[model samples]
Target chain A: MANPLEATVLVLGEQSEIFLGLLKKHFSTIYQLAHIENKEEFLKDNGAEIIAVATSNNVGMSKEMIDALPKLQIIASFGVGYDSIDVDYAKQRGIQVTNTPNVLNDCVADTAMMLTYAVARQLIQANTYVKKGQWTSSFPLTTSLSKKVCGILGMGNIGEAIAKRAEAAGMEIIYHNRTQKNHVDYQYIATLEELAKQADFLILALPSTGETQHIINANILDKMKPSAYLINIARGSVVDEKALVESLKNRQIAGAGLDVFETEPCTESPLFEMENVVLTPHYASGTHETRLAMAELVCENLIHFFNKEPLVTPL
Target chain B: MANPLEATVLVLGEQSEIFLGLLKKHFSTIYQLAHIENKEEFLKDNGAEIIAVATSNNVGMSKEMIDALPKLQIIASFGVGYDSIDVDYAKQRGIQVTNTPNVLNDCVADTAMMLTYAVARQLIQANTYVKKGQWTSSFPLTTSLSKKVCGILGMGNIGEAIAKRAEAAGMEIIYHNRTQKNHVDYQYIATLEELAKQADFLILALPSTGETQHIINANILDKMKPSAYLINIARGSVVDEKALVESLKNRQIAGAGLDVFETEPCTESPLFEMENVVLTPHYASGTHETRLAMAELVCENLIHFFNKEPLVTPL
Candidate 1:
């Protein structure tokens, strides 16, 4: 067992202060990668002493970085998605990997439902209409979610949570997963094309992997009804941004509510100008409550690993 | 019985073409008040022949207007709320009154839930942040609706519908109505003050009437938790707008989601400047599906009354 007083932890990139504070309280020696200048020199001096690498989904552990830290035992990630991390390399190196998952499912699901309503009802445009003093005339009527088909692309924990809310709002839920699960009652479409064709709102909730990358490309977008809306709370890699832009321009689909983009910190895109789309800064699970809970989970996973107990949420 | 071909129907103001067409199909002598140049001359020429008044909640038939048409036997309103119409006088003269209710409950409730999530999640500001190229910096974390208290002011059809959606989002429901409802399983509070103090989201879902006017005034506003949000999808008369603006300015309440204003077509207000508040033009039931359904209900009520059947939804 690694002693809490001696085992060093290296935190990569930016994280919430609460997470940093929790690490500080538990470990005696902590190094933040962001604060370290001249990374080569610093790692040469201190890398071998580091036992755990704390990171976020955005600042994932690369194979090169993993090779640099010779004594690294674990990689504790701060988000549910670990696609950015080279998980295969970590597994080959016999290093434990953990992520904060179930803690954030509700908030992420809430975001998916929020975007569904926001796009379907044109809430952002409605707010703009009122703020710009355009209430003298009636705003154009938008579509309603009730009795509409909500086709989910993934049926994981987050997808199920979203389905519950959509069902409560009088929306019918249908989904297309890699394979159908036995627990849920929602009808499963075997093909993604059929799901897109039948959906009034096509929501992407699957993980981003090599097989899933750019899955919702031109072919799938073409299959969707012109009135259908696309909602993506999943990773940005699942969509082809250029194709989505063209789809919106051509009115191939009604609109989109996107939290993630193909290239983020995506400050400039044609989507910014479109009135039909609602864009957020990749903010699914970006709530104080959920983030804090996630931070706590990340810290707990690290604490459990150091204590030689079973990892709370290990990959 | 009034002959469908001979009985005159006076449509008070501008309505959808679908409504006008529906009326035209059943009645040959249709007079649109907006098309008539001189109301006095038009009333003198055709008022006695008018056996029914077709109007909307916004352009309601007043006591004087009801008196103008001596033969008026029914006033079929196009919305659920008949507060603007002089119902007492209509009843005194044995004139039946009907409104399109139940049909709009789902859409209006969807609006309430959308605003609740929008306000709590800071969705509009987040969109603006991303659009303005501010995603380079992190958008601030916002509150989550899950595990929070949702205090509803009225437990009517719309309120119940909102409650169902809120509950599905992992929120606990507590409500304050004139009297406790019989069928609901949610906790009922006896006083509005307790509900305000306990709620993380205080939703106003009651109607606007003599007793309900200005119910959410400065006193109730002050009672709300500073972290709480106000969602008004009900009539604006139910809330004291001046007090609400003051509360928002002072941050007495975190923010508000307003679908209606005290005096609407409210082009000017202090709320337009507040980032925390989300303003939507009185659009709770403003979806194409619900509007058309309401219009159809209006026509059906008129048809049922003309045929000497019971009204579908009477005030």
Candidate 2:
């Protein structure tokens, strides 16, 4: 007794619990690829019926998977980053792609600010010191973050948010971007190496692309001040992870505050061994409120696409 | 024959190594009170010659010690807070009391902001989770600090600095002060209880006074929203420790970010076991730059007092 107009959407990998319920509430048919006993048989049977794919950037679209879905018309991604998606391939196939954006800016900014302050204040080490009963003597003095020059690499929404917070905390802001963003007064550096050298705290909020790959490489790191710290809330591909580990080891940079890793879940790395750096499991926009907002946006984007309206945030 | 201008200053307790060096550099003669192997014998012989006393709040000027130093003209305290000093008794005896202030505001404000963000994002637990290799799974979503209402309890220089920083981070400003100040844009809450009720984060930046002691008591804590947090950087006596412990245990308030405690060298406490609060060993201004500035101020205060000039920061 299913409606003939009800098209099945293949969910690639496990979606969030919130998203599952929401997806069911809005869509009549659901096909979770991970739960299928035999993917080849299930796809062979239901491939023609599948008109859309709902997935996160974590469980991305692949070329072979795309070929399996003969009737697939759209891909709705949960996260803002679309680096994992083969956009060119999707475009050639005329597969429309949509992503959730802007809804998670506040929480993502909070995360960036959190990491910046956490690394600078040595909160991780200080907290451990207090809990381990080692506060018997006076705690050692750490460097001050106030009044330092906060150099933002990408002057996007998240970077502007970080700058606003850093400014409130008495830090001066300078940045390096592709082109001068109009209607903003923050100083801009011409090159990445110069920006790295001058920044007291260098933060990356750039999107990932082929040209932007390994942007924070050995040369840029070598140019950075020994006292400087780096914060990455953007994609992991932006940084040269091997070079970063070496710089952190040699104290070429004072420390790092990272949310994304070159490879996640960074189960094993030299970063895990260092006390100077803070590692987060790529959850910068991981708050319940932001996630809910993002999930809602994803659902809405899918709905809007099916209704043949302009997408809320087209990728 | 002793030179009147070259005052013999009594150094009480174990002073900071930096302060000890600075003290000796500015003053011609120094007497180490703690190191005087025979205290009574030494006092009997040299007490009358002690023209000034240099001590921290920890080694406060006891009434008996003040009586012993008959020639003491000034008390140069190393830290800003003069709560430990018997200021009235010193005033009665025509003795000057000077403390270092303003020099520590930037660092203190930094500490307050650090705690606010640390508690909001659960930085302490996050750090521990990553270090213990438990980040194989995603970290749970914590609260966002951006756009929250930051209600400052005291609007002094340190509080103002905190406001400026919090404002830049997109937090709305509100405050509860004894009286309304001129030329400030933040909304004023008339009563402390109401302020606590409205705040997402209630920060204590007021000085410790007889009236201000236990200002954040059980009754005031009862008025706070369940989602709100308390940040104490002012002094421990400002909050009722028992009430705070109970509130934290019951989740009456979300959490606390504490840098000051009711007692120094806190060997034991139930708070040590709680994961919701972040604690520091009362080192809000514990940065090299700020400490050095404070030390220099202490030396300058002593030098000014001996030179018969007006006390720089008289208590």
Candidate 3:
């Protein structure tokens, strides 16, 4: 006989209203715990079989919250990055943890390339200059892309996408991944320090993990080419924010394009005052279509968990 | 025997100093005609073999000025768009016209993708939102490129580059060019009208010529999907400015990304006031390495002309 259709779901993350509408269709009664500051009260009131969380630089679920969820059978994350969630702890409790991946590869990769162009050509600064009416009679001659070495930290799906775009821009791709990415085609250095030494533009597209945190600290930055440009589309903790600000101030690196930060709504980073940096608010996959797809995948995972089928992207 | 260098190259463009340096090595002397008012005086002094015109959107050599340079053998334009130089009149005079081509393919293509991302994701507006300190959070989801049809007009070298990047972004590439491009294997349509009908994002990478001017008028835009976006890395004259402004205002098109303009320093255009549109100051080939490559190519072309060798990139 088939299992009874009586699984409760807890939607922990804030998402587009369109996504919330879709969730309501599958669940008997959707418990939106997004704005619920006292998550304990909400958790106690409405029991949940599956928990869904949207990953962001700010406001992630705590370890304590995971332990307290007695009825939580699965935790489905809205994005590929599940650094905020304790996957090991969830696995120990026999709770499946799943994330929306592969779907976000292109979206995240596209944004990384966007940031590269923005920094390489100073697109944002030029836009500001023209809008400010500083372009009295001439267009300023900005930076170029040809002949630059694009250094990638992670050679995953998104990092490879960035590499392809960089190759199109006449840049040579050099990378440092956790392990050999099964291809010996591109130039690969054993360490980040070695990769930084030869690169004209270094990009961070790695996932956030305990081993990867503060990988781009002052020591690594010191090994980078003097005229190099840095781009971080990966986790903020992967780069030391204070060291980056100092490097920008000192002109050790030519410029930077940053999307994610150690703390989001990153209103207080000293890097803000510098003209050489291009800042984006953790919007790698914040586009309408991509986010909606992520939401849909999370819903699918939830439905699959209740149906006793394997999750599409389970950890 | 090779003839001694006799041409007094009168460079009538701002930011021609580097090009002038290269020209001086081959020519007798170089004149930097910075302003339009000095045209008559500069032309009178330099009765030369060629009048190499360097025109950006802001700096253009007029037809009246060309009529004065009787000894001008060629108009070796600095960049691709020769709309500034009267190519038809030059052709009539048997003057060989040349533009630096193939060199700017990657750079311009990179800019096309940049503008596409900027407009589709509202990067500039988001930048403003963050800078104004109003972005305590991300806004409701808007646009994205995943699974959308990117309609490219004029599938020339730069267009192909843009197509590759867009395809990498998971957008389906549908292009319309005068003659089908032999290089790329992308899907091609015979007409702009048909291509625009299916596109979710229409990228204008066409040249500005008599036959091509105002190609993206109200009729073409009306055929586009209501949520479609427009990206122009080509000359601004190719688009009917007024029609675009109206389409954006009425929300007939979702937004636009304009790098070129019919009139630059375009402070008064309705497009400028719209938050939906992303504007760039024609920094398509604005990378440092690309600009230097373009400069070197210009020098080589000038040297080849004087030496009576076959032109490297003949117009």
Which of the numbered candidates is closest to the native, going by highest TM-score? 1
Candidate 3 docking class: medium
Q: Candidate 1: deviation at residue B210, Å?
A: 0.2
Sort all candidates by lDDT, best to worst: 1, 2, 3
**Candidate 1's residue-wise lDDT over A1-315, tens digit each?**
343545578999987887787778777788998998899999999888888989999889899999999988999999999999999999999999999998888889889999999998899989988988888878888889999999999999998999999999999999999999889999999999999999999999999999999999999999999999999999999999899999999999999999999888899999999989999998898898898888878878888888899999999
After best superposition, candidate 3 residue A266: deviation in angstroms?
1.9
Backbone clash pairs for candidate 3 read: A143-B287, A143-B288, A144-B287, A144-B288
lDDT of 3 at A204: 96
Rank candidates by TM-score, best first. 1, 2, 3
- Model 3: per-residue Cα lDDT at residue B74: 62
Off by over 4 Å in 1: A1-6, B1-7
Question: Lowest-lDDT window of 10 residues in candidate 3 chain A?
Answer: A50-59
Give model 1's DockQ, 2 decimals. Answer: 0.84
Query: What residue runs in model 2 are displaced by over 4 Å at the alpha carbon?
Result: A1-9, B1-9, B40-51
- Please give, for residues B56-143, the per-residue lDDT of candidate 3 as tens digits: 3235556676777777766666787777777778788777777788888888988888888888877786665555556587754657
Compose the digit string of candidate 1's lDDT tens values, residues B164-282.
Answer: 99999999999999999999999999999999999999999998889999999999999999999999999999999999999999999999999999988999998999999998888
